[model samples]
Target: MNDPYDNCMAACDACAHAYDACTAAYLAERDAQALADCIALDIECAQLCRFASGAMARRSVLTPSVCALCAQACDLCAAECQRHAHDHCRRCALACEACAAMCRAVA
Candidate 1:
């Protein structure tokens, strides 16, 4: 069955993955000290996206609220990622932007 929130859930999941991958890329080779804010935001955004996805999957009452926050987090992550020149960051930014739009639709 196709759930009404399936698209939002997928977007949230993909956003979380993108943020995680971006963070991993930063930790692996990027200068952690210089990009500390980006790293922190990525972690927060990833967690929020995951939580939002779970809420939707479970059909929680707080899904709207969770998705709203997740959208904000995605926006923040996208802005931070856009500030960087790395390929991972660029990709993550795109993912984040897409996720935010999906989340807003549900919110």
Candidate 2:
């Protein structure tokens, strides 16, 4: 995918990895409300990171705008995940923070 985003690739990987972790947590925790919320945010952040990474990869004109939105989402998702103490939540928060930082760099 055009080598992905040099600046965003790590964040993209983090988001993707966090999504998997969130899914596993959802399955393990089974707390419909909180886990579901975390899972939903994880999925959203992952998808956005993927899209933003792809956009950056293609050097699209819309990348800046996309990155802006990515930063926002990642920030919110990170905050949400950080509210909990679970390992998965902590990992997700870290990933989101990384993604947010990358997005901010290019936004």
Candidate 3:
């Protein structure tokens, strides 16, 4: 059977990928300067998600704390992404929302 953390880990992975893609897309936009905060949050969220996923995979004692921080990062990233109307941003927001919920559930 799959571990309980599997779903959350997968969600984190998805969120990280989405954030990376969204960040890259924002950098390519004409108003890249306008997305500075969004880009920075995306980077932070992605890194946190990666670390949380690894912690969960390893069944580390710090998984819960890591997940708590990951959830916060995802929430902030989602809010930032939601401020933009771009397709990539919208998709990233959705992923971040899902990931945040999953992280909260495990945390």
Q: Which candidate's lDDT is highest?
A: 3
lDDT for position 26 in model 1: 90
Q: What lDDT is obtained when candidate 1 is compared to the true structure?
A: 0.92
Candidate 2 residue runs with Cα over 4 Å from true position: 1-4
- Write model 2 residue lDDT over 1-107, tens digit each, in one string: 44436858667766877877776767777566657776787788888888888888788999999999999998999899888888888888888888898888888
- lDDT at 28, model 2: 78
lDDT of 3 at 49: 95
Model 1 reaches what TM-score against the true structure?
Answer: 0.95
Candidate 3 lDDT, 5-103, residue by residue in tens = 999999999999999999999999998998898889899899999999999999999999999999998998888888888999899999999999999
Q: Estimate each model's TM-score.
A: 0.95, 0.86, 0.97
lDDT of every model, 2 decimals? 0.92, 0.82, 0.94
Q: Candidate 3: where is the Cα deviation over 4 Å?
A: none
Q: Evaluate residue 64 in candidate 2 and report its C-alpha lDDT on the 0 to 100 scale.
A: 90
Q: Model 1 over residues 1-107: C-alpha lDDT tens digits?
A: 88889999998999889999998889887468888888999999999999999999899999999999999989988988998899999999999999999999999
Give candidate 1 regions above 4 Å deviation.
none
Q: How many residue pairs clash in model 2?
A: 0
lDDT of 1 at 56: 93
